[model samples]
Target chain A: MERDDIIEYSLDTHHDEEAGKKIRKKIYFVTVLLSVVTAIEVAMGIIWGKAHIDVDGMGWLTIKSIFIILTLLKAGYIVMVFMHLGDERKSLRNVILIPYVLFIGYLFFILLVESSFIFYVKDVIGWV
Target chain B: MAGEATKAIDQAELWGGGRSPFSVSYGKMMMWFFLISDALTFGGFLSALAFARHHLEDAWPVTENIFFHFPLTHAHLPLLYVALMTFILIISSVTMVLAVEAGHRMDRKGVVKWMAFTVLGGAIFVGSQAWEWMTFIAGPDGLLSTSADNASLTSNPYGPQLYADFFFFITGFHGTHVLSGVVINLIVLIRSMQGWYDERGHYEMVEKVGLYWHFIDLVWVFVFTFFYLI
Candidate 1:
């Protein structure tokens, strides 16, 4: 019969003081990294606000690309560290991430190609 | 007997059937799967926004102008308040990871303390969102008959009606997630306090709740980039 006090696994079995310290250190490091990236994003927004949107050019696209890259970097760190996805097996990581990369890339590809279907392409029919 | 022995060998060579192939708890695996589906759902929302933005091009509302209001002051401080919210969410994510780590050590009090901080951070973020929505509704007035900064599902003074619609839908959906996350964290915090998981011999529930919470924060990073920054 199982007793009320029986803990199947010992309370101290998984506890490693060194591991705990490392985890805490990693948490603080990731937190600061995310904050710094966000601050950079905000600074870019302030610098480009009202000025860039009103004037349409390649510069706006460049700034946007920067934002997207930074955002993805932040997402990667969060998933790997905060959610412990990094600790999972290689097969598990691939199974989870591959679909997202393939599908989301396809979505954005159509976003560039198909979404502008109405616009004039010089190859198709120029001079509206 | 030979056929049965061969079939058992095939099973052993492939999946093994006894241990998890993923090397994670069944519940954690389920949470990961659920988050995958949810991420796709959010991808749809953001992609829809992208479609509209591309179609409208320059006519699209500049995010900085539309969301520039800061509370209790007349200053037009674009992206500052939203940035504050982002930092709060990130810091809370740190506290959540700390709580899960504490659970690993079976330090119940540590779990409780950090979980309380996480809960408070989530509540403040949700409250900040509410203020933002209210400010969005009571938008700017005057300057043009097309009006200044007001927004509604049908009307928008800034750019197009589509702007208001997408804003409401994307941020609204994410805010709903945050609200639900807050509620879930509160429930988990109470259970941790009550020694519910200690009796079960594991604090796996905290870990599960933590995965959900971090997922919420993860989605917010995307929303902030796609909606506001880009």
Candidate 2:
């Protein structure tokens, strides 16, 4: 089959070796980034999860917050890079990602707030 | 009169929409749409878990304490296995994207190799999840059920009984996804070897499947954080 018959995405570029090498390098780079983030998260959970070290006035940099933030960061990178959203047009990226972010925020708000409200009611009213 | 009216409608513009609307193929667009919905489903489940734990409050099982057992060793090791599983999934996701990249280059050999690794990674992860489920169900020291009526809120020793229920349900649901991903990946790997994508002139199938695989990996990241780390 003729080479021209095959369609080229960024990786091919009419059989350019450098283009293929560059794409391969990008894949490994992402792998390293994700591994580092996972290691950080696991370390945080292991080291400070139970320590509860308090800051003077700023409140404790709780392990929970660290886990959430790190997880979100990892998730964002995985979505952007692995799913190829980062290479997509800005408008396409926004169209796919923004609404999910909004929905997740809304879901978290409701569940967290309502749970606290329920906890208060149950404790105060002596209800099961 | 009818021919003139039809010509006025600009038939070329009406029938042909030029390039794809989002400049992505139909398959990729649909995959994104499906993943968005799937993400919400997972988000809902995780939020429900948070709600249950919050309601249980002080009675909720300390996640670290509950998931502390490492395989073969009796010593309490918090998040060790779960963290390993997360790494495996992340590595598999990397391989999957590599496969897609190889496909973009029309490198048949590279696609097969990377995708096979991805399938292997996925199989291992699913097996590990099964092991986790078995270990969890068996409980530490073989205490499967403290009593027959274990569901009762009053007599439960392990905080709220809902903790175990949620743990099983959420992880089981996610495990099923991983299982299906493995199957789908295996199919894609085989097809690549058969020159399926090469015949089609593009490796978009690999890209589509890669999207799903990465989404599963992404979900596991959240699950690992909320389910075990927290």
Candidate 3:
């Protein structure tokens, strides 16, 4: 009786037609958007490389920065939209996502400090 | 007739039931917990990758040159393979959703058919990933060289060590997840065909597996952007 009851319970909760359709549509839209954005990023890379556009006297850095920003934007969209985290309860979403954001931010800080230290050491001391 | 009987049984079990401390279904709750832990694992990997990229002293490989390689033509094209990967994953998610819908209708045959397609899609995606990995690890033209005299990292004509490292780590992690997902789907698919869930009359397993499959596809979206586009 217990095993049969559990199996019945599983069957009752298994099917979700409406929700499935909605999620499918959402996934398709997000996929199209991701593909389009990828194409744009690649095109931008090509144009930036070819034009040799100098933004505030930083050519490669400006291009790289723009690329990074766009990539991060796409990543955020994927997490929020396709993952359905955007629709989840704000509290629950924050609980799962906030720590990740903070940790990644902390990582960036460490990278910046360490990279600067390395630059100073190499440039000042003539050390490779 | 059986549907009504099943509903009555559920109500009896719910209201006449001894209270279970956990209100939510076990499988659904477990899926959520799994996703949370998986999120943290991916976050840690990405952060470590960023750290490595920061400390490396060389230009990161441009995504266009490294990943954009065209097979058989020797032409470097960007985003094409990743775009294909994205489509494969997205289509698989769609099929999984369809399977869930079939499960809802108690259309056992529908569930089996859709699930088989979903498994095929997953297998294809993994194969594509394996090909991508081969391209990455072998380097272009099979030659690995270091850029600077002091640099210990091996690189090729395509890019830098940091690029190769992150490419391998991030994509490899995601690929492993996809492989596991395929296995899970296979199990569910076999069970569905075996009338295991059919007799019980609920396709919640399909929904649960769908959730996991969709999550993998979702993660790939971010990975494609960060590792290939950026």
Candidate 4:
């Protein structure tokens, strides 16, 4: 291949004035969304604390689960938008992330198994 | 035959340019790969924390209480210090973005100026983290008054040793990262002022460093949420 062809293939010339404006606007929108969601999460936590209703159907576990989900959503938005990972090719993004995801999965597996065994030994066997 | 082989070798070297399939500049590509690995490390830590929390279900300490401490006040305040840390990190990230903008405009003075602020922000963050660590390790209300204190690693108002242990390990690991990031930013800022990459006619180095700095800040955002807010 010619040198010019190689340069043409490798160089990125995608950014333009209009594209820049659009990206800036998108970034602002994402920021507003993140802030609004965060506020909602905080408000939910406060309301839960103040009510102390114990809402027997769902229980405390359910409330905690909701909080965790909201937290993950906030984190996802930050990574996808603010970090610009959402703009990259899916393959490139996955290539950069999959290993960490797998390793974390493995770690969680070990923790679950070990913790259960310990719990059984302590609570059932009176080993403590 | 020998002449033909030499010619082919020259063509290969010229065309390949010794670049990998990624085809990105060495610095930017390496930074991205490093961040990928670093992200995994943090994810592993957080998973371990979650597992601990799940297993010890009944005994997890309220994170708000553990992290809440006020400076120069007798009253115990929760979540304020971590909030301040978050602000510092966000401001540093903003400064880094400004530096990248300066690089794009080929404004050497602007790059240096923004990078200096970025470094300062990182340094202040590290300092705050040190204070946070001191507060954590020292134990609130001093080491001697264990009973007076609501919670200690040895005994929590809520639960077991696992909670305190995880808190210390997770936050300490992140604090160490912040400390190293501060050092790295300081080096980059000094190099920028010295015109190291300036003469090369590309500020790609600033962009690479900016990416690393932002990744650090991004990781801290998750850390703050998982380890504190959640």
Candidate 5:
């Protein structure tokens, strides 16, 4: 008898070795991509440290932005490829990712802006 | 009878019942929902860290100075150890994916092998974190303890007190997740060996656990970036 669970959810995954090889290739590609991005991030951190520049300067800010961007790139690969969300149906993907993008984006904005304001307040109060 | 029941239902109803709207199993759907909530929790912690880092201004310690030690070496490496930990977690993620792939093919032996590696990687990562905490709280000069009478939370020689607090809290939280992931992996690995999925005639359990495993790795990426890298 055909298992209804498998049929209903369409568990008809890549079953053969030929299809497995293609999936393996994609896995290797994503692994390398994540590693390279991580290496580049570390390299940037080292180079920035060696520069002996002002931590609060515009240059530091630019580098921080780069770090955030690269981190997001790494996150994208992990979520899409490693998590296999990329292969999942679009409805599932939307249900999972939409809230995160919107909520986290708003949270970061509000918190960071308020953080700077707090810093200013602490500065006035001679508080570290 | 159920096949007839399914056929009797309107196919285009979408949510008219007798159908999965997301085209995934119910367990998988619930897993995704759980992961969404978990992501927000981690998001709150990391963003709060960011908030405090900025709130303290120049009082925040440069992470390099705080975390420069490497194992078995006196040389100052600066974030190198954390970098290694990141690679370990990523490699485990790869192994978890491989295991999931093997499950899809119903290659029982392949699933067991890859799951073993995944569990090992997670154990190593958590152990490394413990070692890191040891070194972190016991600094080069003296105790890095923020709780000692000599240095309380309000004042500490190692930059701001919030620095150590957040370091412990955020990374500690991530470490707990990794630890649990390892346990879950071990259970799944043993079950895979005992032919549990084989008896069930499907390996959706492996895929579900794989999703959770990948989410753990995903969280680590964010933690490494926010906690160590930047």
Candidate 6:
């Protein structure tokens, strides 16, 4: 096959060694970010469980919410950066992310609502 | 009449040509669609878990108690091993990114080296998952099953039966994904070594697989928070 025929389309503009080095540096930065977040998560779990640090007036619900938010931050970063969605066009990114976000929100709303109803029916009203 | 014919031909050409409406390669676009659907599936499972946990309320098992063990150390190390696994998977993602970057430059040697490391990282993760599964099934004290229907936690201190059920099902499903990821990475690694992508003069295959591997790690982040930490 001819050289021209085998060349595939790509968004990478690494035409030289210097560009490649810069890309590698970006990768290391992402790695460090992810590691730091994971470390924070683990530390939180330990302090809450073992050290038993009691937050004044903050319930377990508040603590759990913090964990959930941090987890979402980590997930968003991985999808945007490592998956390279950040480099894609704005329309493409919106098209891919909007539907999933809407669906997940709907699912959470329905499930949580239904679950609360069940709790009241079973525990509060004493119905099976 | 000639002008009308030309317009019709232009429309036909636009429709028939292999063009990417989103300006992305067909494979990458398809990967995005697949990931969106897969994310919904995972969301469904996790929502069901939350539904169950909400119903059970205080009856649900506390995570820190159950996942406190580390390899070779008897002391309680809640979430330690899992944190290490998360780190390893994240590092592998970094290597996969490097491989894709190398592929962009048509650097065969860099691609080969980074891809090999990516495969090795995937293998280690799968092994770690297997060990975790073994530990989960065995339980800290011992197995306590009243019937063949399921593994019962009647005797264990890890709360009710439903918690075990969700733990096994969710983590087990995630483990299967990791296992398949390892196999896929191996195949890609072998092909990279053989210069398959080198011959094609593009490393889009590495990018596609990197998308998948990163997705697996992303899901684990949620699973870790929901099932272990929270």
lDDT of 1 by residue, A4-83 (tens): 22212212235667889988998999888999999999998999854455446778778888888999999999999999
Error of 4 at B53 (Å): 2.2
Q: Candidate 2: which docking quality band?
A: acceptable
Against the true two-chain complex, what DockQ does each candidate achieve? 0.36, 0.37, 0.23, 0.26, 0.48, 0.41
Give a tens-digit lDDT track for model 4, residues B90-122: 667767766665665566787899889988888
Model 1, which residues run further than 4 Å from truth?
A1-13, A53-55, A121-128, B1-17, B142-150
The best candidate in terms of DockQ = 5
RMSD of each: 7.0, 6.6, 6.9, 5.8, 4.7, 6.0
Which residue ranges in model 3 land beyond 4 Å of their true spot? A1-31, A38-95, A98-128, B1-23, B143-162
Best by lDDT: 5
Question: Could you tell me every candidate's TM-score relative to the true structure?
Answer: 0.87, 0.85, 0.72, 0.76, 0.89, 0.87
Residue lDDT tens for model 5, B104-134: 8899999999999999999999999999878
Cα lDDT of all candidates, in order? 0.81, 0.77, 0.68, 0.65, 0.82, 0.77
Q: What would the DockQ be for model 2?
A: 0.37
Q: Going through the candidates in order, what is the number of backbone clashes in each?
A: 0, 0, 4, 1, 0, 0
* Positional deviation of residue A29's Cα in model 3 after best superposition, in angstroms: 4.2
Report how closely model 1 matches the true complex, as a DockQ value.
Answer: 0.36
Better of 2 and 6 by TM-score: 6
lDDT of 5 by residue, A18-115 (tens): 89999999999999999999888887887785235597679888888888899889889888888888888776788889978999999999999998
What digit string (tens of lDDT, one per residue) describes model 2 on residues B1-230? 12122113223322244334444555677788999888889988998998887767667666676577777888878888888999999999988988887887788999999999999999999999887766666554545565543323234345677887777778888999999999999999999999987887778788898999999999899988887777
**Fnat, 2 decimals, each candidate:** 0.60, 0.57, 0.26, 0.19, 0.60, 0.63
Error of 6 at B66 (Å): 0.9
Model 2 ranges with Cα > 4 A deviation: A1-15, A50-61, A125-128, B1-18, B143-157
lDDT of 5 at B193: 99
Clashes of 6: 0
Worst 10 residues of 4 chain B by lDDT: B1-10
